[model samples]
Target: MNDALLALTPTLELPSVAREQALKKQTNISDYDFLLGWLYPEDELLPPNLALFSKTTGPVFIDFLGGKKNHRRQFGGGKGQPLARAVGIASDFTPKVIDATAGMGGDAFVFATLGCEVLMIERSPIVAALLQDALNRAHLELQLEAEGKTYRFDDDEHSFLTATISRMQLVNADAADYLNHTKPEADAIYLDPMYPEKKKKAATNKEMTALQGLVGPDIDSSKLLEAAMTVAKKRVAVKRPAKAEPIQLESGKKPSASIQSPNTRYDLYVVASTQS
Candidate 1:
């Protein structure tokens, strides 16, 4: 089989060890070999197409199952903001969004609709490659179906997904590894790791169950906020269970001073940069 990537841009590389470790974490008996577009020899699904999710809108249930929202109304694309809104990201639908982890790209798509220029970074090679593919296909189809419209994908000059959401950029890279170095000051940064679901809602829907077989749990999710703090021009928003204590604050790193929405209980950490 040709390891020759099918796309038109440079494939994002992963640390061989991390890639192996990440892949090993996949609970599937057959690996995500399908990501390479390997024809599945059995009766199972291939990597998902963007079209399936292209139509999704309104409050994102995918996040409710996994527990995160990428684009809040404050960012212009959310039905509701993430937990961090209490600290002051606000519900006015601020501006652009950077989705550090694109898992299934559900959150990213929501923000795209709010007309935010969303920059989505995903680390898994198969997942990234598949997202790029779907974005490319959907971007092209949407463009062709319209007049004088285009969005870049496949490393092209413009993307339809970007145009559809006003503007978007999908960069293939590890969420933790990439955000550590990136400094694009977005209005908001959204982070949602695969948390242990509340037992009441443990049985996930079909797509999520499939996603679980792919990305596994976001084992390194805790580190995302610190990185987001340094980059986001506005705030670092994390969505958590309504009952769970705020992530870093629970450990006492954040000051005792609190913000609004204490009753909702999810926390939003306002990085100093966005305040200006």
Candidate 2:
């Protein structure tokens, strides 16, 4: 780990019974501070307050199965949203999206809920572990929901949540390396590189502030874009703030088109051929 990451390392706290599972699944625990606390398989922190949480930002988690923000996004005009349109969700084809920089997996969850199979890759071990914990908890909740034992959702909602969770996959890997080696071609490759911080106070929210402090910005995002162009079958979509310029490209590569929303834009780069 780098010096910056070493300084910001998180402590993994799991229940005594789950210690073996944590050790087997989390190989990087030795590099971090280990604590003993129970994470009650449900999407919550158990008693004694032991959870897979961030010291800087308390109790970081992923909850696509609930919350008003996520629910509003999933059941609202998501399919007609600019991101969906940029990835050709309106077309006769169902696109499989690869979220190269799945920091919090928020966008990946959005795509998955919209019926697009999304594969997420995160490079930061801390962030990856947090995301993995969130995903595991989410899957468990979905399973319980499917069996009508948790989260009072209608039958249609339950089925939709189950399908959405099934469509999503996560991996802790460098985006460039994964793209270089992955065999199956993704219909759309998505990039959401961290935007450079503004020079003013309160420039962003708490979550983003904590995130930028941890992972920093994706300085090599252009290289990631290059790798995506090589593997994506239909297009590579890059998400950016509406006013920000599109991602930098090498000498010849360029984005084919752009889809714009009030707050963000999707720069679509079409690949030359289907074969790698």
Candidate 3:
């Protein structure tokens, strides 16, 4: 592993349950020798038993069952949001989405809640571990909700939450490799590669900052776009900063259309064969 990636996990300690889950995931933490183990106090406010803490950059973890994810699902726009528009969601047609870069699983969660079957691929083992933990917990919570055990949400929210879990599948792999070798059929492929921030100081979000620190920029996003174009049956959606230019594929073609919001722009590459 590179020194920068190693720096992302200065301390990688797992709680007992997280260790058990890691074993089931076939991921051995011992292989990452550079990560030291630092025990947290039992009363610490962390939700997931495991977390990746960087002294310089705060800890990062996933919590789909509660906290930010729950809040977003409850109040966030369902199918009317810009991302939904970018992916081409409609009242009569809900396209299957392959979220090639499933960072933290936010977009996938939204798509799933909107009745789209979403296949999420996360390449980083560390990020995948966090996502898997959240997915497992979310599934359990959905089961409880189905049995009328949890009352934190109403019937509509509960139903959508259940659908999100049932429709989502997380896979740990590179998006390019998955699209190339697996040939998994999907109506659309969504790419949210980390583009260069327009303003260095304007990027204040902790999660995104830590993510960029770990993964760096997606320098080969154009190549990924090429792979996505070949695989997507309907279209490919690339999320970009508002000012960034649309991705240019190997054929020197840009997105056919683009939808813009205040903070981001979604560039859509509609396949000629699958246009509606």
Candidate 4:
């Protein structure tokens, strides 16, 4: 580990070469020493318990993974369900989705679980690296945890769907660049840029702050919306504080329906309707 990276945790003393391996495998300095996580709670690093969530009891960890994945989500009120249900691209056909703003891979995974081949483009190298690490480590068993993540989200027993979803890929790139330049085939484009907390008392997720440090501002969020609207066949779904107005608020497009959750709201822009 670089001395600077080690400064974060003394136990994370991987050499450059070994650190590269750990990053590739999604292992962190903390993985080498779970105690780092305990000591540096302010660093926003999760406990080793998160290292291999596939082994946890039933859906508790899995569901927690989903919530952590969706930083905008809270514990109760089923907020994630409705947001995941949102599909607003103007598409003549249904196919894969492009999560342009894959903040922490939560929305991207949601789009994937919805059966869309999600091509996630994350702007921040560090965030992208972290996400890749999580997905990569999830696919393998580790000493600190059990049952690698598999990346196969499906639950079919008789079929390979449980493992087939490993096909999803994460890319390190700015969302605006991909949308404006690439002519990739996609049915829907999703954007969930971080917004101001709904209320002053609102609690911001630490993981979110960690991501923000890596990924500066969505400086061109408006342009992202424009490109997504132009490309997506169905519609563009933007996650916002339930109380906050739409990101592209002035645009004539209003959300088809707003799903209310205890913490956040799903602002859905319907380019067109889908089977759901």
Candidate 5:
């Protein structure tokens, strides 16, 4: 584990059950700088969720069962969504995707919901723990729904959530290393390297702020992209800020095409051959 990761300690307020879970997760992680613990909701019936707490920021956690994730899953423009299109999801084709920088697994979930099998790779054990916890909780809800037991969420929600979780896989490893060593076969490889924050813009959301602090910038993103290019059978899509330039490659290669949205851009590197 990184030195920064080694410094984390569980919060004192974590309940017994959550504490146990956090400790179990810690067995795999060496350290962390922030508080690794669970946050219980005001409603006693709700299950406790894992979070990373810092002095300045609110609790940072991944939540797929409720909140914005649910809303996006239910009505985020379906396959027509920008991310979906960028990764080549269509009626005739749904590419299996590898999310190389699967931060909070937010975009990976989106692809999963759209019926794409997604492999999420995260290097940080801290963030991966939070993501795994969220997935575990979501799976529990799915299992409850299968047993016809009462759940906090509605019936219609379970169908998609179940399918989505089933299609998503998480792995904790460095993206470049994983891609190069495993050589996993996938139709698309998605990269969303963390770019430097703008000084003039307002502060980013709590999740992003905490994530940036924990993982820092993706300085080796170019190397990761090179590995991805060699692995992806069809294309590699890199997410960039709307105004930011595309990632520079040492080979001096350029994207085959670019897709733009209001806030983001996707630089598509159409793989000419898998051998590359």
Candidate 6:
């Protein structure tokens, strides 16, 4: 957990099912300082959400059902988005993607919304738990909608969100280790290893600030990139700050191509062959 001050708080008076699941997650995390607790909504209709109660950053949780994520899922440029293009998404093809450093799952959800099957790998157990909780809640909402019950979104939007959520899968593991052991099946590998915080830019969002504090930087990103290149069947996409230099591989190799957006760049390494 990168030596972050984190701990599981006592489960609140949640619905029976949600309480059980929260307890399981609490048991899974071995070390932490403060608390892992639920933030109950004032609206009785809204469900209680699992959150990491950080003294420095307040509560941090992943919410795919609403908020910025849902808004992006609805309006974020479809396949035309830079992230989609970087992963080789086209009208004729939608690549299965493995997100090697799936911090907070923002990018993974975007890929899923674009109709790509996305495997999100997060090394931090705390982040992984939050992601899993969000996925579970999203799936439950989808199931309720299918049963002709109350849903958070309208019918059309419900259908779209359901499909998007269904396409995403999460795993808590070291990216390099997972990629090295798994078969080279995914068409693209996406790496968004954390970069050092820039001094000149405005402070990052609380979610990102908390994440950086917990996971720290990916010092071994170059090695992870190498492993991803070996495992990815078609290409490996490394997301970098627009002005930042590309990751330096131990093999002295460089990205085959680069795709740029206003604030970010995707360094593409087209895979030539797979290692045995």
Candidate 3 CA-lDDT value: 0.74
lDDT of each prediction vs. the true structure? 0.52, 0.70, 0.74, 0.52, 0.81, 0.79
lDDT, candidate 4, 1-276, per-residue tens: 333334433322222223224334454433431111111112232322221111111111122133454343333223236655565322343357888887667666655544567888887654554566556544432212224323323334213223323635788887777777885667767788865433356444555544443344565677788778767766677777667777654466666767677767766665654526
TM-score of each: 0.61, 0.78, 0.80, 0.60, 0.85, 0.85
Off by over 4 Å in 2: 1-56, 201-203, 274-276
- By summed lDDT, which 10 consecutive residues of candidate 5 come out lowest? 8-17
The alpha-carbon lDDT assigned to residue 218 of candidate 4 equals 65
Candidate 3 lDDT over 116-178, as tens digits, reads 999999987777766776787677666766786655668877776777788889899888988
Regions of candidate 4 where Cα sits further than 4 Å from its true position: 2-80, 88-95, 141-165, 196-199, 249-257, 272-276
Error of 1 at 122 (Å): 1.1
Q: Which tens-of-lDDT digit does each residue in 1-276 have in candidate 1?
A: 223343412453311112222334443323332222222213232222221111111111122111233233224334454333432333576467888877767667666655567788887665666566656545444554354433212433234333544455788777666777767768778776677545476456655655555567776666777777777766666756556666653235562233334333445667665444
| lDDT accuracy of residue 205 in candidate 2 | 46
| Worst window of 10 by summed lDDT in candidate 1 | 51-60
In candidate 5, the residue pairs with backbone N, CA or C atoms under 3 Å apart (3 or more residues apart, or in different chains) clash, namely 5-31, 5-32, 6-31, 6-32, 7-32, 8-32
- The number of the candidate with the highest lDDT is 5
**Better-scoring candidate (TM-score), 2 or 4:** 2
Clashing pairs in 6: 6-32, 6-33, 8-36, 9-36
Q: Which ten residues in a row have the lowest lDDT in candidate 2?
A: 45-54
Q: How far is candidate 4 from the true structure (C-alpha RMSD, Å)?
A: 9.7
Candidate 6's residue-wise lDDT over 175-238, tens digit each? 8988888764799999998987767978788789888877788899988998988888889999
